[model samples]
Target: MKTPIIMIAMLSLSAPALAGGDMPVKTSTEVAYQDLNLATAQGQKKLSDRIDIAARRVCKLDNSITGTRIRDRDAERCYVAAKERANQQFAAVVEQHAKGG
Candidate 1:
C-alpha cells in the first residue's frame, strides 16, 4: 500500500531572563500525522489531541524550579508565546483538515 501523507510539526519557545538567564530554557512539542485520511474529522481530532498532549508534556513544570518567582514569571510568558506559535503554525493545516480538502 502507498504510504499516507505525513505532516510533522515541531515548535520550541522560550526567552532569556533580564540579564543572566540560562539558555532561554526551550520547551517544545513535535507531532506527527500519518493517518490514512487526515482530511477527515476523526483524523484531525486525533492529530489535535496528540499535539495538545505533546505541548502539555513539554510545558510541564519542573518541581525543582516551581517555587522560584522569577522562573514562574518566565514560565508563564514562555507558555503563552509557545502556545501562540503552535497555533499560528498549525492553523492552516487544521483548517485544511476540517474543510476536508
Candidate 2:
C-alpha cells in the first residue's frame, strides 16, 4: 500500500512582476497525511492546518522580513489562491480514497 500525498503550489506574478518586471515564479510543497485518517473530523482539521502552513510557505507569506508593502497584498492573494487549490486537491484525494482507489 502506498501512502497518499497532497501537493500545494503557488504560481503568481511574483515580486519581480509586482515591481514592473515580466517574470513569474512557481513554488510548491507537499503534505503527507498517510498517518491521518481523513474520515474523521479531527484528522481533517489537522490536514487543513498543514495545508495552511504549506500555502503560506509556497506564497512566501510565512516570513515578515521578506516582503515589501506593495508585495504584501500580492502575497495575501497568492496565499488565498494557493490554499483554495490545495483544498480542491484534498477533496479529490478524499473522494478517491472513499472509492477504494
Candidate 3:
C-alpha cells in the first residue's frame, strides 16, 4: 500500500512532463494564417497584404545575402534563416491577436 502511494505521488509530480500537456503552442505564421482565415473579407485582404510584404522582404534579404550564384548549401542556410524569422514574426502576431490587441 505504501509503495503504491509513493508511486502515485511520483507520477503526479511528473505528470506534466510526461504528458506534455500545455498551451496550444502555435507559430506566428500559424496565428497570422488563422486570423486571416477567420477574418472578414477585408481583414483577410489586409493580412494577405502583410504576408506578401513579409515574404518579399525575406526573399530580397535571402537573395542579397546568398547572391544570384547561390549553391545548394547557401540556399539552405538562407532558407533556414528566413524561415526562423518568419516563424518568430508569425508567433508574435498570433500572441498579440490572442491578447485582443
> Which candidate number would show the highest TM-score if scored against the true structure?
2
Estimate candidate 2's alpha-carbon lDDT, on a 0 to 1 scale.
0.82
Q: Over the stretch 6-81, how does candidate 3's per-residue lDDT look in tens digits?
A: 0000011123444797543222222135435322567545654565445444334334533556534433444455
User: Tens digits of per-residue lDDT for model 1 on 1-101?
Assistant: 32333332323333344245544444454666655356667776676666566654566533246455444544455555555666664676666656765
Q: What is the C-alpha RMSD of each candidate to the true structure, in Å?
A: 5.5, 3.2, 17.9
Candidate 2: worst 10 consecutive residues by lDDT? 62-71
lDDT of 2 by residue, 1-101 (tens): 65588888877885667698666767788999988888888888999999998888888885675455444777789898888888998998778777877
Better of 1 and 2 by lDDT: 2
Cand. 3 Cα-lDDT: 0.41
- Which parts of model 3 have CA positions greater than 4 angstroms off? 1-35, 38-71
Tell me the TM-score of model 2. Answer: 0.78
lDDT of model number 1: 0.53
TM-score of 3: 0.35
Cα deviation of 23 in candidate 1 (Å)? 2.8
TM-score, per-candidate, Cα-based: 0.52, 0.78, 0.35
Task: List candidate 1 stretches off by more than 4 Å.
Answer: 1-21, 61-77, 95-101
